[model samples]
Target: MDVEYLHHGVPLADYQLTKADRRRQDEAAQVHEWVQRQLAKAPPWSEERWERMRQLLGPPVPPWELQRWQLRLYCGHVVEATRSRERPRPDGGVCDEERCPECGMDPAVIVAFEPPANNHSPKSSRFARRPPSDRRSKAELVAENNALRAELKSLRGQA
Candidate 1:
């Protein structure tokens, strides 16, 4: 038997990822774990339960997971991070003016809330549909629309 070494997209080899890709993958894993935990808490889903879960998990970070940005500070208060314009200093050096607007920390400390490895469900989905607990059902809405149309017809006839 002969040994072959392949470098370009070959199988049985570790692939390299860029910094951005690695960051995105890590973020996705964290968000997935958080979502799974939240979902588990609201099992046998309902609209109210789903909404509560959404509030607890926050909004989806977008493009990958369903979670919100929870900015934690050293003071133990939760806040949001925003981009700010650079300010010019006396030495003509530019500084990042971005900070926690709530606490006004020059360099806002970021605290990530990553769920533990065992908290995630391997068979879960990234997105979930709303449960059948909304106030108005589709059939009810359709019947109400028909009733309104009939009432409008009667009013037009009287006019």
Candidate 2:
């Protein structure tokens, strides 16, 4: 099969990637290996584990899978790439500066959060803490309201 090849700024199959490109590739491969090792620590990762990894990585997985995996396992977290200002239009009628480069239509925004992987607190722990003093059960509140109303009615009749 005919093949087209490009390397760095150079072209053709003979051309090789530049020093920078090789460095980047190496780093990426290292990360991939790291991720595999992390996974290997446990038994074969299940589909759910993969999905959780994806969520932690966020959309568009980063070049370093190992770092991403570490972030996932440490605590459920996602990192967003930094966004820069957009460019202006040619005619000057519309501009890209106010809008996002990724979506093009919406303004750029960053959101980051880490949620606990599981609510694994013990069932016995629940009873350890006292409920709020101000809180009353629905039934108790309703009954109290009925009694008040009855008392008010009796007072009105006496008047």
Candidate 3:
């Protein structure tokens, strides 16, 4: 029998991986399998974890006392007017009113939430249709205009 020289602690002929290398590869495979299983598992939302998440997000706002409400659909879509029922037209035909324009579902079936804004009055949809803002009343705007005119007049007189 003839023996070949060894290079880098490995035999030149019939080269084979060492026992330590085989054990290391097996350990690496086990670690990779464990990581894959962990990734596949869903997040465990225990009561404590849920409570912590709640703490991060403040308490829910009170629902508006409006007959109509803006709804956030389960599919993450939002639409205005939730409770408005369709009415018949003068020609004795069904009105072309739709509860939800996006999903074409009735207001009752869609998941609804009060719009997260308080600028609009709860009793009326007219204000809700308008943008949410602290707009000045017509009287206030007139008063401001008059005040500005008077100031301009006074400045001109002084000049």
Candidate 4:
């Protein structure tokens, strides 16, 4: 049998075919022929296939679903928020912001209660004997502060 050889659509001489090169060329030709046969055998798109695809895909989802209520930030800015599929809706319907986008104030550090002064305490001895309000060591506090600063820096960089 006689065969014409081509490399990237350009004609090649028979002398160009080394033993390894011939094996590679044969493998490539077999792969191309297999792909062509597979493509020819593939079923054509039909209404049945389309319906099956839709069924598998389920309902179309919107980019975001608007919540029934709005989010009230610590900065007093009211913004419309989207409801997450993974998380359940808030009990109050509205969600409170941890960090205000408008004023850039983080509500996470807000102090809910302050320890009464030594003299102002009804039980002075009990209050005096009580442990420090913040039990964290100086090193721990510094580490926490550094971590928070780093996080803030990264967040600012992203913005």
Give the TM-scores of the predictions, in the order they appear.
0.26, 0.23, 0.23, 0.21
Evaluated with lDDT, which candidate comes out highest?
A: 3
lDDT of every predicted structure (CA atoms)? 0.42, 0.36, 0.44, 0.43
What overall lDDT, based on C-alpha atoms, would model 4 receive against the true structure? Answer: 0.43
The TM-score, computed over Cα atoms with residue i paired to residue i, of candidate 2 is 0.23
lDDT of 4 by residue, 54-82 (tens): 99999866543222223443234443444
Better of 1 and 4 by TM-score: 1
lDDT by residue for model 2 (88-156), tens: 111113211122333442222111112122321222233233446756899999999999999999999
**Candidates by TM-score, descending order:** 1, 2, 3, 4
User: What is the lDDT, from 0 to 100, of the residue 107 in candidate 2?
Assistant: 25
Better of 3 and 4 by TM-score: 3
lDDT of 3 by residue, 37-134 (tens): 99789686799998999999987643442233344433335555423222111111331122456765332222224433532333244534333466
TM-score of 1: 0.26
lDDT of 2: 0.36
Candidate 4: C-alpha RMSD after superposition: 30.8
Quick one: best TM-score, which candidate? 1
- Number of residue pairs clashing in candidate 3, backbone atoms closer than 3 angstroms, sequence gap of 3 or more or interchain: 0
RMSD of each: 22.5, 21.2, 28.3, 30.8
Ranking by lDDT: 3, 4, 1, 2
User: In model 4, which range of ten residues has the least summed lDDT?
Assistant: 1-10
